[model samples]
Target: MTGRKALSRALDLSLWKGALTTAGSREAADAVTERAVPNEPTVRLTAVRRLYEVSTRMGAGRSLAETLQAVVDGVVTGLGFGIAVLNLRHPDGKFEVIAVAGSPEAREALLGTVSAADIFDGEFKIADEWGRLRFVPHERLPEGEVVGWVPDVPVSADPSAWHPLDALFAPLHSPDGELVGMLSVDLPEDQRRPGPIHRELLEIFATQAGLAIDKARLTDQLLAEKVRLEASETTFRLVFEGAGNGMATLAFDGPEAGRVLRVNDAFCRITGYPHDRLIGSRLLDYLTDGDAGRTRRELQELATGTGPYRFERTFRRADGQDIWLGGTAVIVAQGKDQPRILLIQIDDVTARKDAERELQHHAAHDPLTGLANRRLLQHRFEAALQRSRQRGRRGVLLFSDLNHFKQVNDRYGHEAGDNALREIADRLLTAVRHGDTVARLGGDEFVILAEEIDGTDLDALIRRVEESIGRPLAGIDVPVTASIGTAVVSPYSADLDELLRTADQAMYEAKHRDR
Candidate 1:
């Protein structure tokens, strides 16, 4: 009896193992079939296949609107809903109808009239008072209405018969927790309560639909960013290549003399050299002999990170032309390597410097007479006085005023007066020694500073100035004369302001005497 019992137990164990194997195989097959046919009998297997194909095609679409319309069509066809509406919220906190399908009248009624408050707060009401069965919001229903729309229903029951006409609302949410839109399905009372399986399927579809919407939005955002970046890069390249100023980058390896690393097209155009010829060439090779040692030291100091250097230096261009460059050098490091002494920026300021020198000339000289203006004369006068005082010598200040300048201007116009001034300046310049300073102190007034002179020599200088001014002006046939007053100051009594005042008084006395 014991042997038979043991054998029976072993056979039962073998039967159990076989049963487990068969059950596992059946489960795997069922999984494959479910994947193959996602929809149930309500939706034919072929319909499910077509739905997937359409979804795949729509997924490859570029426009978000097209993709969404395809999704809405697939869901409506697959689920057999009477009315389907896809509403999307905009950035302005308003809901917009994105996709709709069903009766034409119903679609037109729901298009732009729906709002967030209408769907979430307001209740759907079904009434028999109207000739045709229609669903309206509860607020629109008259007072004392007995029958209202279905409020809540079980997930497992057949809602089609119990609540023949009802409304369904499902919120579409994105993965990042943004409320994208609301999906609403309206059906008759007979199709009110959806079954457990149907509800589960709807939930799955909703999740997948949200993911598709997010993917479409992300694709659009990426495309826009790509366009913006490309535009920015193009703008930078154009400016770098077409700018009128010269720019160059030098690499600092060991400070033996930094070499040119990169140069823009403007640099090549300005220097008359091609980019290939300048790269890897030492910057010191272009410097003139007078500035070579200083330039070398400056580049070395930049390599040591002392300070930024900026100065004017003459460089030999490729065509053997000497040009002035206003250069600036600094130290920079792109990576963890040692700091690169970047002799980075240089501007071909030859034209600007030349213009600046011309401007300086205009500032120091009078336009009408081409003589030194008062500002320049004052600067020279102070320097001469200081020199005379240091050397214990005497100097004379002669203040001269034209005798009849206004009468000449009134008779012959300002142009002839200007010619007279020019002629007088030329004659006075010739009469004075090269060391003397002559200046125009505005309308019809002039001054001269004669330094390192004795009393007799001073008198002779004054006589020469008077003779030169009395001579006939070239363009004007009239003879112009100037009344001159001389003031002499030795180191003992040389006060600039007092001497000027005394010279003015003496000038008035000379004019009175000439009159």
Candidate 2:
């Protein structure tokens, strides 16, 4: 072999022996160590072997800190370096000593370099052949940068003098093969600089170290996620058990439609069903037939994406009492195997519904006669006009006034007068069709809004009204007559006010003609 080739061969063999010592025995380590140069081969071999061993223990190391410490231990011990530091780039854009291995003095010196100011914004070069180690002083590094421990002066040398130490660095990469930080080893002033073998050994060690560290980081993230999932389960359980409002989950498309999957305690309390009784039961079983049927249709429509999730339904409680329930449903899944689960929330609204019904009754009906009042008459009048314009349906308005009814109140008491008015309201109701509206517009003035009528039906309607109102006043033993005037509501855009005015005018003319 040529001289250069022989030397390179020797170097390769030496490294192999160092790597092979663990791969083999002590004789293998000495086989390469005795060649031409003196080196800590056993040390580099141990570090490389340490890297291999540590790399194997990846699944056990659950934190990056533990993994980095293992790497630095291999670095300082395997290379006989004065100091070893594992500096990692943090999220805050700073490099800090996350792990260190060295003598007490060396470790303290390396730790002194750790501060908020130690940002990893520096530059250096790695030779392509000896591609791992880069030695640089603090001054050559970026601002606020610190690397390597202070060099130890020899005891035989000058005591007052201090010597500078240089850092030997290797890149630590992430799982994605991106350089995330550096693994730095250094020597005291009396120790020699790192040579080719030192650089090569460190480079190899770093490759494995980076893999171990990144794997450990990923393991830590997984562990953290597991902890979060357990905590979330606990919190959700607490909320579901202690909530005040009724809540339940329903399964769609089961043999028992809307079968209750799960129900909170509040839901059981609201529905007056025990936990065991509710679980296997259908939700519609507890609701009125009409409302339950409507809800089932709406839920089917909901699956077709054609309805709102929120609706009002009346439920039949366990005691057969009815209660209004405001409810909302949300589908949580899709597909047949995983039938859509509905999360339902319910609130009792029976009292509110009752109050609303009472208010509507008072607004639409007269207190004395229980007939529709003038306000309701106006509403129906406007609605009839709209229906006539839209559907080509005809209507009739019979304006009837009680003639000389004031004399009954003048002679008899007002109580008897009220009785007379009530009797007239009864007669009016009996005369009109079931769909018609007979409204008292104060005093003895009453109007009938008969819908779905035509010119042919008007005469029959007028006859019914005139015959009913002309009956005797039973309490007073006297006859009461009424002037019943009619106006036809054509299936055209007829104004309500104009029609009422014409009917009123015709009523007065009828009164004069009757007198």
Candidate 3:
């Protein structure tokens, strides 16, 4: 018979008066049988149709507990049973009531009452006393427990007992051979016992249910991953497009020229060019006039894989202003045609370069007098000595200490002393030749490097410095004297330290004579 026809026959058999007669005592059997079979087929068909529709509706059910509950509801209502319960194997190998349906009393009594161990062992003592017979797998049951029912053993034994008659338990197994849970059913004692037909039906239902549950779980996981991936993409886009730093990509075309493929807003702002104008333009179009050829050659070498170059260059901005850019460019070709091309990265370094130049000026020149400081004087003297050695020439190193300068500072304060030093520096600068270097050696002391000078010329340079110092200050009319000492050295003298010491000693001797 077709499934619908078979269902009609089962309904007819369940409602048969003959079956009711064999159910048990007339009064009790009639009452239970009346409740099991409705007065009309329409009500029964409606229940069956609703159960089938809902069970088929299990599209993406993730939770095992929820799916099990759905199964319990569908089986009990659809099959015209009084009660249904679902039991699942716990992690510890015990069984727990996962879901239950039917009367409140039946649900409470069956909930958490039985376990897999109890059912597997055919421990039906509670069911037997309650007029209920437990069904186990034929292969699984103990031989003694597989007994045929005798007439003497009343079907409706007692109401207070643990088990119910017409109970069916079928293991719910997944497609991968995992036993997920068990489906159990109960009916009044007078109802027909569960047989192979009922077992087969329950097994099919459980298989469909299990597959639906797995699908739902996978769907939920995929949705969560998709959300995370989209979120990551949003974060990346915000950082790449909204960053303050200039970021761009250049497509390599040839040695000196490449097209700008992408540029962020910061790049446009820094280069003073619009995005539309910058894209597809050659990188060399912005290069300063003097660096065009050299940069082109470097880019060519980079493209040919012959050199790695990193240097600073000046670029003309959109407004025709020159801006210093410090950056590196390299060749990048991800297996494309004409692989010889350059990828350029540039950053505005005008502020940084200016700060470096200012620092260098402060290090070598005195802040107050604008003369070369002691450090610069030492460097120049060493360079001059090296040159003198190469040409067999001699240079004079003059160390001069201002005599009685402390009295001026003590009497007039440091401000006036500073003015006096400024006037002295100007006089020394005027007295020295263009090639000579005059430096302040700190605390009212000065040093002069006279290159390619003999003894006579050295004496003249010293006298000119002394006369300038002794000249009266123009505004303050303060007379100052500087005691001068000179040390001559050739590059043959290997000891620079000894030369500086001799110069210092001679300065002290001249100070003593002036005093």
**Tens digits of lDDT, candidate 3, 355-409:** 9888999999999888899778778878998899899999888888887788778
Which residue ranges in model 3 land beyond 4 Å of their true spot? 1-243, 247-265, 272-298, 304-311, 314-323, 334-341, 360-370, 455-460, 508-515
Residue 256, model 2: lDDT of: 52
Provide the TM-score for each candidate, comma-separated.
0.46, 0.47, 0.45
lDDT digits (tens) for residues 5-75 of candidate 1: 11011111221234334546655533443453334343333333433343444444456776567556655
**TM accuracy, model 1:** 0.46
Go through the candidates in order and give the C-alpha RMSD of each one to the true structure: 25.8, 23.7, 27.1
- Per-residue C-alpha lDDT of model 2 across residues 1-515, encoded as one tens digit per residue: 01100101111122232343553655553343345233444433444454334333422345777667767766655555545677775666556667766554334534424444233223344222234445554334345533332232221132322123234567676534456667766552223445444554465456556655655665552112211101121111111333334667677666755888677777888878888998888888887789888988888877766212566788888887888887556454332243456667666768889999989988998988999987888898888888888888778888888877888888887899899999889988898888899998888888899987876688888888888878887677556778877777867636767777888999999989877
| Model 1 misplaced regions, further than 4 Å | 1-245, 249-262, 274-294, 306-324, 332-341, 350-363, 511-515
Question: What's the lDDT for residue 427 in model 3?
Answer: 95
User: What are the Cα lDDT values of the candidates?
Assistant: 0.58, 0.61, 0.58
